[model samples]
Target: MEIKLVKAIPGDVLLLHDVQTRAFQPLLEKYLDYEKNPANEPINRLFEKIQYSSFFKMVVDQKCVGGIRIVARNNSYWISPIFVLPEFQGKGIAQQAICQVEEIFTKHNIWELQTILEEQGNCYLYEKLGYERTDFEQVVNDRMTLVGYRKIKN
Candidate 1:
């Protein structure tokens, strides 16, 4: 399938919000991470992110399947909440999107992200993409923890 990362515009906020909520809903229900779950966030928060961060729609075969948000500072970049719809999971869309975003930001040498530690698939994906797990972690709930990862490009 053809995959592309299209820069998000303000008009795409509702679509982004919808896709994000749908993509993260199962996780939200599983983890009950109301405060930290994108599915639980308001549309306004997504609008703000679109305005402030580099948000891209993960388009596959001309359809918007998911999104990735990047927060950049100098040579470092933070990737938060990259997701694919539940139906679209296990297809490597998220990995392709991440690689495409990194290609778009070629000047950035450091990439950072966080994922649910309990979700081994998520951890495996990031590690497969060359991200090294850091010591930093946030315990979200008794059943969930967020682990930090960083990739330094040389």
Candidate 2:
């Protein structure tokens, strides 16, 4: 399977929104009450974020199966939301996307991301890709707990 990372444009806002919603539907169903999920964001809000962040489409064999959004803060790259369509989860597309971002954002000395504490798969994926879980977490309401991770370049 071939994977590629491409910069996203304004035209992809709706596509990204759809991917985000479809990918997180299972999590929403599992938790049954996660209002803080990225998939819960409105399309207009996604458009606003796309305007400022480095948005990328995770393309596989010429199809878009996922996307990631990275933002800059205090010289560190923050990968806020990375979504892979449920159908595409087993593949290594998301990992490839993360590697691509590491290459693309080479100027940054540090990278960070956050995810729901219960998402073992996401936590494993980030850790395998060199991110270290920080000793910080937040209780997002009763149904959700957020965990943070960071990777610093040597």
Candidate 3:
């Protein structure tokens, strides 16, 4: 169960998009977050993301199980999206991936991300990983809200 994060290349866009869609589909269906769900994003959008962000393939035993997208500015880093396929979730892959990404960006002292406020599991995972909830919250709909989190390393 070796988990690895490989820098994604442009040619990997289609595969990454497919994995992203599969990973986010259940959440999209449950939340009906049509405008913000990565499941509804076009392949071209993912391709563009690969060009600008530090997109990495979440590989386990040489198989691409999911991906994580990171945006960096100065000493801060933002993890916009991180997902594992439905079948791959709960295997601690995402946790390991996040740790690895943070290690890879050793110079970064501030890390931030957002997740659905209603999803306790998601919030718990981030909290367990040392992310503290920020006061910021975005109401996505009547049923869903996005909450921000941040972790600062000393």
lDDT against the true structure, per candidate, is 0.92, 0.86, 0.92
Q: Please give the lDDT score for candidate 3.
A: 0.92
Per-residue alpha-carbon lDDT of candidate 3 for residues 1-154, written as tens digits (9 for 90 to 100) = 5698999999999899999999999999999999999999999989999998899999988899999999997779999889999998888888999888988887778999999999898898999999999999999988899999999977
Give the lDDT ranking, best first. 3, 1, 2
Candidate 1 TM-score, true structure as reference: 0.97
Clashing pairs in 3: none
What is candidate 2's lDDT per residue for 54-77, written digit by digit as tens? 888888878889889899898899
Output the TM-score of candidate 2: 0.93
TM-scores, one per candidate: 0.97, 0.93, 0.96
Model 3 reaches what TM-score against the true structure? 0.96
Better of 2 and 3 by lDDT: 3
Looking at model 1, the pairs that clash are: none
Give per-residue lDDT, candidate 1, residue 85: 89
